[model samples]
Target: MSEEKPQRKIIHVDMDAFYASVEQLDNPELRGKPVAVGGSETRGVVSAASYEARKFGVRSALSGVLAKKYCPDLIFVRPRFDRYKEVSNKIRQIFHEFTDLVEPLSLDEAYLDVTQNKKGNPSASLIAKEIRERILAETGLTASAGISVNKFVAKIASDVNKPNGQKTIGPDEVESFLEQLPIKKFYGVGKVTTERMYQLGIFTGADLKAQSLEFLEKHFGKSGTYYYYAVRGIHNSEVKPERTTKSVAAEHTFNENLSSEIYMQEQLQAIAEQLAKRLKRYELAGKTVTLKIKYSDFTLQTRSKTLPYFISDKGLILETATELLYQERMKDSVRLLGISLSNLNNEERKTVVVQLRFEF
Candidate 1:
């Protein structure tokens, strides 16, 4: 009798030691040597270290001093985020070749649904292999990929054979894989949760599966539901492409509270200048400018002004802020002053897209 296979196909691709690997790709001399990319001081930490460095007990986020202690001859390099971003865009373009449903976890990691892909490749494992080969060919860097029927198992599979390796966990293998998984390896389980799990004698996936849902909920509160479903290899959350800015605020606490209008105006101008810079950075223009004032007595008040058109200009922001500040009737010095711009633009259109997430 022929058995039917499940129809879901998911792939999780993670660049192995992404930042460090990118550094090695750019400079041929740094390959196969202990390389750490981040700061170069006692106060700094390693953001990423090469596999060679990892051999000497060095890792990302470790203090430079500790890393040096492990490998005295370790080389530390500064991170060039701009260059990293350029390479990331290149990698993303490569992903679009396989599937448009790519959900980037960060600059280095992403999930792709290749069940009905643009490439017309029916095998998810083959797509993952091709993607890895493409990434190495295009960027001269190595990446690890996991192929599975769902995102959860695929993410775990990617880490199983890391650093220039690929893994696949089919529907039939997920049960055994789950039984052997450490509870700490489960997504969303942090250091504190892992410690709590250990205290509760929940050391592995087997232990977690043995616990009652009510016990998980009682211990973890609202997030208990997540723990329960994770053991069963289920995650219903979709990858969200559009991220909304709830609010944009520019605030500066005064070194000293100001009673004089002249000083307050000076402060507002500086804040508006900062606000303008941020808006331009995000490629957004705001229609409403709100002023926040905290008086010496700790009482707070706010006033807002809406414009006919979206703007990110410094002069316009300062003018609007000054007018709103003037309207606030305050008899005391202000300890804090802030300017917020909201009612964001959508698709470069003048029409405002108010976040339904926001309540008036």
Candidate 2:
């Protein structure tokens, strides 16, 4: 008889409207208001929009102009990335308490491999609920969690109930769920892929599964095999830790789009302070500082410069970031502004020396 291996347990957690939520949480006046962490205007793109703004079709990465069309009364505000990172760290600390198998996907999302956890918890669903609750309790923010037997199902499950909700995809119900899953809901099926799939009559998991493996492979290459198995709830991906993180950033959206250079520089200053805090917290230093800007029309632009050596000093990073911001030509009404540090250098691992003794 063959020995049975333990099942893989993965959990996916994502912040609900991360940037916008942070903005709303910090200022009581901002709550329930149509707030966006991007420039307010038709020139810049929206970086992050609150739930209230989203009702008007406002969304992240949309041009400020389009956002206004969706919600004309939308109030734009500059991004405060520094504050967001502080909140993110608090959330990360909470994840570690349950299990060390954390893999941060971004500042806003992560995958946790809790198959064998520190707490020795039997059920992943319980752990997920607890984590979501803790996130709310600790950061005054809402998060959604997806618990499943593997990474693929876990990620999909997390999105099933969004904005302060939790969902579980048990092993038994995997097939039934996939059968009704719209192609658009599949992880990798983006706008371009969906349009193409629609034209080819691929609407749901059943539609996707009807195609032969050979045909899918012919079109999507190696990813085709993923689609073939993914629709059937087979996922083998692992939770990769963020030990390789090389940078940290902070950014903000504005209430009103600004074409004025002076105002944009002021926004950069705030973002720089926030970026510096994250760098110091992680004990990291970087040689490069980058400034990101978005126009009200949704056009994006960035400028970056590398220093002679990596440093974690706030003043130095801000100086370099400020320089980069100035170097760029202000062409349109800026809706969003951001700052980030990269090309990191910090402490190296210590190697211990051991002595051996010979006895007679």
Candidate 3:
């Protein structure tokens, strides 16, 4: 007889238009309007757009100028990342009540492994429901959830019922569910990959499954092997808790391009200060400092240096960033300047080790 496979319960939770929803909740007047959270319409890009704004073809990452052209009445509000982080902490607290196996993807999304939970609850769906209700009650915001046996399925399922909803995929239904899914709907399959898949006559999960593993590997490289097993509902990747923060960064886009090195240094100082505060808040320090510059002609350049010791002091970060800035020859007038710190020191890093066992 075959050994029984271990079953895992995973849940993916995503806040609905998190930033725009927060804006609406705080100010009653902004509710039900086409609102975008970003910089001024004169420059910069839309960071997030409300569902109403999306109706007019406005979306996150769309340039602010184009967003205005799409919806002239679109209200652009500056992003409040600190406020969003505060709310994210509250949501995380709720997840902890059910499971300690929580992995935050961003300020608005997370993955929780509840196969074994604090409440000793085996029903992942019920836990997802309770979580959503608690989030709505505590934050006055709606979150959608997806519950499944693994991270990949759960992450995809969460989006099926977006904007204050939830979906579940049972173990028995996994293969069938994937077979009917469109190629573009697969997680990690970007526009370029989709175009390639379409050209190869692979438009759905079923079509992808029809190809031999050897054929997939020959054509798509390592990812082809992933698709072969994924289509058949085989995924062994564990749900990692507390995803690492590889870097911390802060950036600013100016209305007018800056040509003078002195003025650029001033902007870099402010950005370094912001980065230092973020590092301090997270109790993290780094040995590397990187400077990024975007010129008016849309050209981008970056320079980085690694220090001997990890330092999170504002003055030290500014000094290092300025040095890097000056080292690079000016390509063109700058429109944006930023700084980032890497090589973080995370004290709570988790590692798992496996050993072979033989049954007598």
Candidate 4:
């Protein structure tokens, strides 16, 4: 007789409006008021909007001027990425207390594999609860968790009861749960894909499942296979720990755009310093340095150079970033300055030298 495969326990934790919530937690004046963390309302974009602002149709990636139009009383706060990174590190530390298989999707969300965990508890739901509670107790912030057998279901389940709540989908309930799910709710089904599905008479998971694999593949290609299996609760992706830093970067959008070379250099220096600190903290060095610039009119450009050797020094970063900054003439007044280190020297395995003794 064939043996049954082991079912893995996974959890997806997402902070509720993380950036905006952090702002509200730190500043009492911002609580209960429509708030956005981004640049000025004059000529920039919204990075995150609080729930209060969301009610007025303000959302991240929306232009600040339009966000203000949506919410007349919207208060905009500049983003403090350093503080956000600090909080993210705290959250990751908490995850490690339960399990080492923590995969961070961004600063605000992560997937955890707790099938074999330090706590020796079999209940993933209980672990998630404890993690959320600890995050609130330690950082004074709330997070929502979804416990399931796989990452796909867990991620979708996390959104079912958002804003400081959780949901669990057991192995037995997978099919029933997917059947009634709206097509729009399916992962990877964006607005355009959802509309296409609607045009094809596929409104729900049930509708999608009705099509044969050949039909789906014929119409949707590779993504169709994804939807075919995903709706059946057959996602098998694993959570991978961030064993190495991928890129070190820092960027700042100015309150007022500056045109002078001196002002640009000042901003680049600060960005380079921030990048240097991040690289040093991770014990990483890179051969490629990239400089990202955004003009007052919102046009963007990037210049990069690959050094002969990997360097993590602040002086090298500042010098390279400064050189990139002046490599081209100013197209317009600059509103944003950014520096990033790529081609990192990560994932290298250390070799151990051993001495052999021979007895005659």
Candidate 5:
């Protein structure tokens, strides 16, 4: 007598504050103030913030001079990214109208699975409240969700009631909701693994389910078997609708600080023409071509080259990022410049897992 192996719904969807709420939804006098999309309160950073600039703690990689000293009426807005990818393709066409098993993860989060959908809905919390009310009635924007039973507790319950709101755990409340969560709200625990799980005292998920999977693989060696089956709710990762584009980049960050290499090959020819217009808008091509360097005391360097073919031109990515920016030299006074492309021709699309059974 052995059965039980079907429990997967998943959800995640997240947006709210996506590029400062799409610059306050296409500027209506930046609605209720405090916006901030990119940066320039005298330099760069802050790639998004709003919820009235996160109430004075203005986040998202902060520092447009400390987010104008933490919201001196912060209002910087300049990152349309093609109007946030045309409202992230109309909220991914309203999440494929219920589920093609989406998985996006950026342009503003995603990870649906719906455990058998196409609107014969069986409540993944009312299909994440009708996909956050049809992404606020077709992109006036405002989304947040997190139903569960996988994709790591629906990506930490889509940040428990953030901006808009949503949160479902069910399946008998996913093991006491991951045992009272908070190992820095786990979902790939960061900030250096939440200070190495608070120096091993593991601060919750019931202190990492009282250790030992051989003491968390002797202290997280393979993420200690993913915090031992994610606090025993046991995740079986899925919801992957073809996501593969390993690398294609472009960078600049230089409002001053280039101690000439003919101004770093004229800023690597405008970052290899914005990485060849993002590898010709994803018709992608690559065979390695990295060359990132940021100095002015913020020390960092990289130089790479690997090609026998694949290259998305812009004069061959500025002649291999100007031969790795003169194959390296001035280690000081640089301030950032980048270009990247990496062994890609974009293939790798074969993930089809469909296990059905649902109950919320």
Candidate 6:
């Protein structure tokens, strides 16, 4: 008989309204008020929204104009990335205290593998609670956590009881917890994918599990296999300590739409300069340069060109972006301009796996 693999304990931790919460934590008067981090009422997009603003449908990626329309009293604060980074570093330090097996998804969230940990704690739920308490105490911030046997379930569980809360799906409960979950709640299933699943009559994990691997692959391609395994609580991806930077980009939203190629070229020049500076800071270069254009009506389009060799110079980026700008006729008045570099020079870091003895 084959030996059954031991269940792994994973935890996903996410800060509550990280950017907006940081704003509130810094400014005592902003507490309990609707706040948005980034963007202006006249132009730009909201990077994050406080829970109060969320009540009015204010959310990240929402246009500032619509955000203000949703909450007339919404207060817009410029994003202070440095401050947010400072807080993020503190939270990461706290995670390292428990386990070195941590994978940060963003500045506000991460996945931790504590099946074997520095604290020698057997109860992942208790460890999650303690880590949250430490975050609250150290950063004056509230965090939510999900504890489960794998990253997929842990990530989903983190959102179950959000904003200073946590939930754990133990090994014995993993299958049923996933079976009853809404299909949309699966981590990688976005709006388009959810709609596709809905059309295929896959509304819940149970429905997904009912489909054959061949059927799922036929519909979702490689992702079909993911769905087949995920619903069975079979995610094997580990919590990687080092996440790769897939791309680097810089973008600007104009206060007014630009109709002239000359004006657009000028904006791309500035964006290219910013992108180059960022790439230089990281000591990275890329062979692919992509131009992102957003029209006044919010229709998005992208143009990309691959070079013979990697380049991070502003002049080269600007030249390529300029070519792309004039490559196509104006679809509509351009409202946003961006430059991005991909196929980066950063080397892929390999992960080392370790065997652990599970106590739970």
> Candidate 5's error at 311, in angstroms?
15
**Candidates ranked by TM-score, best first?**
6, 3, 4, 2, 1, 5
Candidate 4 achieves a global lDDT of 0.87
User: Which regions of candidate 2 are displaced past 4 Å?
Assistant: 1-6, 246-360
Error (Å) of candidate 6 at residue 360 is 2.6
Error of 2 at 301 (Å): 16
Model 6 has a clash total of 0
Best by TM-score: 6
TM-score of each: 0.71, 0.71, 0.84, 0.75, 0.35, 0.87
Worst 10 residues of 5 by lDDT: 1-10
12-79 in candidate 2: lDDT tens per residue?
99999999899888889999998889766857678899999989888898888788888988989898
Error of 3 at 111 (Å): 0.8
For model 6, what is the alpha-carbon lDDT of residue 63? 96
**Whole-model lDDT values for every prediction:** 0.82, 0.81, 0.88, 0.87, 0.84, 0.92
| Residue-by-residue lDDT tens digits, candidate 6, 1-360 | 122435899999999999999999999999999999988899889999999999999999999999999999999999887789889999999999999999998899999999889998899999999999999999999999999988999999999998799999988888899899999999899999999999999999999999999999999999998888888888888889988899999999897899999999988888999899889766799999999999999999999999999999999999999998889898899999999999998888888968576765
Mind giving the per-residue lDDT tens digits that candidate 4 earns over 1-360?
A: 112323678899999999999999999999999999995678779999999999999999898899998899999999987789899999999999998888888899999988878897878899999999999999999999998877888998999999899999888787789899999998789999999899999999999989988888888999888888888888877677754567889998888899998888988777888888888766799999999989998998999999999999989999998899889799899898899999999874333222122110
User: Between 2 and 5, whose lDDT is larger?
Assistant: 5
Sort all candidates by lDDT, best to worst: 6, 3, 4, 5, 1, 2
Q: Model 4 — which ten-residue stretch has the worst lDDT?
A: 351-360
Model 2, position 186: C-alpha lDDT score: 89
Candidate 6 residues lying further than 4 Å off, grouped into runs, are 1-6, 251-263, 273-288, 292-316, 323-337, 343-345
Candidate 4 — which residues are off by over 4 angstroms? 1-6, 243-285, 288-307, 311-341, 348-360
The 10-residue segment with the lowest total lDDT in model 6: 1-10
Error of 2 at 120 (Å): 2.0
Query: Which candidate has the top score in lDDT?
Result: 6
Instruction: Give candidate 2's error at residue 241 in angstroms.
Output: 2.1
